[model samples]
Target: MANLPTLGQRFRRGWNAFLDKKAYENFNIIGGGYSGPNYRTILSTNTEQSIISPILNRAAVDISMIPLRHSRVDENNIYKGTIDSGLNNCLSLTANIDQTAYSFMVDVAMSLFDEGIIAVVPVDTSISILDSSSFEILSLRTGKIIQWYPRHVLVRLYNDNTGQREDLTLLKSSIAIVENPLYSVMNEPNSTLKRLVAKLNLLDAIDNQSGSGKLDLIMQVPYAIRSEQKRELAEKRLAALETQLKDSKYGVAYADAT
Candidate 1:
């Protein structure tokens, strides 16, 4: 089997391939939708620690795809899913970073299951489309399926004319959590419950880091596309975080943001 690659590595490879194929045009500047001359393949994996199989490595992915409609369908080739599915719909995708025996199937199922989600239009987040659904989440490039959640799905549609994915978050607001003070005290006094809380906090921290990294990537895409500025800023930020991770500074321990 092919070896696995980190998420960042996979992204780098995908973007590079996109550059080589001049796939930018496939992304319409005016028209909202993704056009395809063809498709491509790629792989991902965890590090070598589990090469012996004594350990298990689970790598989960989130996917998002732009949906196409009647006019969206290419004149040359056609898609097999819903004929009425519009170009604005997303196909969610996901999978373990490690290639498991059923990885592909599992990922596809998740995407298919999450095919439709109701949310405001991406173009105008303020305008609610009670009948419309969010784009099915899928692998950014491969269109693989991951897990699906309606609340989590944000409607992002491409403007056929502009080729830009529209954001509708402003049209509606993300749900806010109102934490109860007692909830925070449930695990107090250093008990197993506290330990669990600590673990959860750590997981949340990791997720936040991953999320910020993703945003950083998006912000730096212009530079990446040009292949001009070396990702020095990103690298520096990573180096700082690497030091913190080594020091076990992530998670919930250590007071005050370093």
Candidate 2:
């Protein structure tokens, strides 16, 4: 007979499986409703963790305080002079018009920390989308991707002035995206911080639903459930109450009795 897998082998298999997982997918539902991916729940959870995880905020703030960079990190400066003037002007400002470069970088860091993904989208172009120089530039916006398509992506832009979210569909060629930064530490299903955020999300959900429950709802029936006839009446009343709750537009049930 073939021997069963040893304990070490079984442990290794389980660990590997855990490491391969992406997300626990806890964002789909919150407060008994579908929470679409504007990342509200995740952000709410991250905000709740500020006290416990102060370092996260501190690090984010420090990094965001740094000015935006025109060239790559530690990139050879030899090619800096060769860069286009229009591109240089464009680099002076962030792609996001709603935000200054400071806030743009901050939001980018915050979004990565909270949602694990972000995008820089080109919303307009000076001459053509392909033009690189000659004092030409398109506009750029920093935002998160809500949906992806074959040739285009649906992005949710942050509007600071109006404090309202705006979504745009932009071509794939002009978008720079970073997904799942520090995946193992920040985004993986079983990672410590990821698990912490998931747990925080669960707690935040519970907190939001704490007082918004059916506790205030009360059902009344005149008869007891002891006898067969009374049981039928009680069931009917309960069913009617359920139907009333379901049929109402705002979960309000109306009844009249003399």
Candidate 3:
């Protein structure tokens, strides 16, 4: 053990030692190119060997290399901007790095949601007690208003002129009203790419709304895209939150609450 180093020391040594390493050479694919194999390679030399590798751990250093693959060319096939755009949107998210207005807005919105800033509005109609003159009356109900308090207003519709009987069908319309304000904020053309920027900002604002106070029924915004990556990110975040809940010693963490 005279020469042996501790894990921490070894890790540091590996990181420092691997600072200069050549990773890729002869970066070419087989059976590629229009005329012949269009090959490219970093001819290994003192110059190539000087390239650096990233230290990952005490035992591992990270270096990236081009993969060898067969290439095909078809004359009839045409390459179009549409294909590029599609690839940029789906397969390559980096395409939108500069394109998206304020990239952090999505993260801000998601963080707000993760921090219990999200609110859910129940679409189903149910019985609600309305007090009029200290007397409860069944009335035709439309919806419960959701907004910032003190300034927020709630308007309920009743079935009869006397407001005695409650109508549940009208309650479904509540969801409709909840969404309008968000769109209105998005549509305001006071800023850059106003609508899209507003939509993204609105999401962040909505998520932060729950932090202000208690929320009964509120609107939930849609995600940018219901993709597998988004789902996996959500699942991982939820798992982390669950682990924190377990550590908190809070009795019976409710999965349904998330």
Candidate 4:
């Protein structure tokens, strides 16, 4: 029993398991990806890791908060007075029955930033051709682009009234597609941000191991587990390591022989 942990040291170990409830409950699916296997890992990573979501959310909010107006610029493309237009009325008064300008823009901007593309489908409009003079929006919905076509595209638009996603195929004329603002950077197959997300996702998967049980790791104590002082120090170090592993965004702890 000399090499074994004393009773008090064993009791101290239980403190490390305090934050294990979530890990325990989600033992089967700690690091599982989102429903689709396509390009949504960045969004999933945003949920788990605290690296990118805040910036994206803040950008969306800031962009949505900006005042929008319909205006005619001068011949030199300089600032001109605002124009009274139906477009301005539709955008400012009501994006849809359930959303204001800010809410609608938040959804649009978030999708554009997170998924790189969003579809603005004209749910109800005055004209099919959308002629500048006659075009008027009665209602609109923001949607995630599911399929692309020359003349039409499929989208999954969330209905606020029903609280569910409604799939719709919109003709090219009835839908406007907005891509990410940083299209040049995000369009790359070898996107650095995507690579970082992949790495974080893999790390998250590894971290799931700790959710089920303790890591299959060992440490050779520098000296004998004899004196009370050494035992306490060793226990302190082990408890710290355990807490670090459990409490980290991804379960990783750094240590070296010191």
TM-scores for all candidates: the values are: 0.17, 0.44, 0.13, 0.50
Return the candidate ranking by TM-score, descending: 4, 2, 1, 3
Candidates' C-alpha lDDT: 0.36, 0.61, 0.32, 0.71
For model 4, residues 201-252, the per-residue Cα lDDT tens digits are: 8899888976868557788777898899999989889889999988998888
For residues 1-258, write the lDDT of model 3, one tens digit per residue. Answer: 478778998777755436543432332422122442111111223321122111111111111111211233468654423333322232223212222212222322222222212221222123331212122111111233333344333333222223232223222322223232233332223444545445766887988886864435332324543888977766676676567666766534443334
Evaluate model 2: give its lDDT: 0.61
lDDT of 1: 0.36
Top-lDDT candidate index: 4
Runs in model 4 deviating more than 4 A are 1-50, 74-79, 127-133, 160-163, 181-258
Which is the winner by lDDT between candidate 1 and candidate 3? 1
Compare candidates 2 and 4 on lDDT and give the better one. 4
Per-residue lDDT over 3-42 for candidate 2, one digit per residue giving the tens place of the 0 to 100 score: 9889998887755657755554453331233234232323
lDDT of 4 at 232: 92
Residue pairs with clashing backbones, model 2: 95-140, 95-141, 124-138, 125-138
Candidate 2 lowest-lDDT run of ten: 30-39
Q: After superposition, how far is residue 45 of candidate 3 from its true place, in Å?
A: 74
Residues 89-146, candidate 1: write the lDDT tens digits: 3222222122221443333323233332122222232323444444332212213212
Total residue pair clashes for candidate 4: 0
- TM-score, cand. 2 vs. native: 0.44
